[model samples]
Target: MELPVVKYNRSHYIETDTGNKVSRKSVIYGSQNITLSGKTIIQAGCVIRGDLRRAGGGQTLVIAIGRYCLLGENSVIRPPHKTYKGVFSYYPMKIGDYVAIGENSIVEAANIGNHVQIGKNCIIGRFAIIKDGCRIEDHTVIAPNTVIPSFSVYSGSPGRLVGELPECAPEMYEARSKEFYSKFMAT
Candidate 1:
């Protein structure tokens, strides 16, 4: 399938044949440590920090982003950090497919499952595990080490389970993501 393209000043962000559109303005560190499956979009001003390797690491992957994912503008995705046995260490971050992270959000999650939508200006704390088919409302603040069940909607300062997602959430999310990608082209 042919992915869409978005236009910028003179330089355009083209979706590659593999279905990835990475903005030139985005900051990606340790590219070797970050794996993008395919059909992923990293918007302008987004910062993905893969440079922070694991403690006692010998060439380990830090960040893994799945296919059909969209990271909004100015968002920050980084591995969660903690002190282990008196030594500060950074763990890996895993994000699943068809996930959309809204603008200006900070994600330090250990795992974000497929078909998840995280709204703008949110803060996902370290080691937080967000299951599949979940929706995180805008400006929500998820506490550290929190575990969110699948097929649910979360919101608020401490991120509570506000509602549950429909059984067809995965299909709906897939369609929405594809549609968004298709319309992300420059006029």
Candidate 2:
């Protein structure tokens, strides 16, 4: 099914040369450390924390989001942190193409693969690795250090493998995300 045209106020967003639409109402820290690929949409009230890194001052990539991705309203995207040798360090979050995260989600994953769809009010725990073609249902809480395999549907509070997706899931997800981006427009 195709998505309906979603319109946003022209004055509320900043459209990039690469076709990314970022909301002015959203708070994105350390913008230089964050990379948003083309055609990505970051909705209002979202918070992307790129400033939460190690003390070393060289430019470390905190978050790298791929093409045709959407981060919904009030969502939080932060890099995962780990304490090693009595020092805390934040690792980069890498999100692949055609990913869509629903409203009110907080994702601190180490990596999210292509065609992944995460639902509303979800909490993807720190250092979790979600593989390609995965669907995480609404209000789900994936545990830390969890590794979600490809082509699976996970749900519930401590998200478990509830079901398996068909082999055609990748193609379907790609089409769906692309269509959503196409219909998302400025009013």
Candidate 3:
């Protein structure tokens, strides 16, 4: 069976054959350093900064997003930056499959694992590691260098582990992600 084509605002975006819907309003710099593994949706007003290379500066990849990932409108995905040896430098950002980032969020995380859900207006700090099947609540601020364990629910301003995910959470996320991908369309 053939897959359905995902339609979008053609004047403002382009939907690739691999199911990548990238809006023209979004700023994706250094496309060479950014890899989208297909079925990724980058919404309007989003900014993905792949221009920042590694600290050593040797043609390293900056942002690598896996399949069925969604970056919501007005959100910013940038590599984590730090001052090392009295010089400011940036590090790479890695995101796994079936991840969804909510609107207006700023993500500077080093790694985001599979089936992770980050809510609206959230702030994921520098070098933070989000493990698989984690759900981050809206307006939460994850501390820099923090590590989130798998199958956990995190919330609050400073971001605390409020609870653990249900046993069926992973399967649920997979279904939901696929459903969302299939339903995303302009008309």
Tell me the whole-model lDDT of each prediction, alpha carbons only.
0.91, 0.95, 0.92
Q: Model 1, stretches more than 4 Å misplaced?
A: 1-10, 14-17, 55-57
Q: Model 2, 127: alpha-carbon shift in Å?
A: 0.2
**Which candidate wins on lDDT?**
2
The deviation in Å at residue 21 for candidate 3 is 0.6
Q: Model 2, poorest ten-residue lDDT window?
A: 53-62
Structural similarity to truth (TM-score) of each candidate: 0.92, 0.98, 0.92
Cα error, residue 6 of model 2, in Å, equals 0.8
Ordered list by TM-score, greatest first:
2, 3, 1
| Candidates ranked, most accurate by lDDT first | 2, 3, 1
Q: Could you give the C-alpha RMSD of every candidate to the true structure, in order shown?
A: 3.0, 0.7, 3.4
Where in model 3 is the C-alpha error above 4 Å?
Answer: 1-7, 55-58
Cα lDDT, model 3, residue 115:
93
Of the two candidates 2 and 3, the one with more favorable TM-score, higher being better, is: 2
Q: How close is candidate 2 to the true structure, as a TM-score?
A: 0.98
Displacement of the residue 114 alpha carbon in candidate 2, Å: 0.5
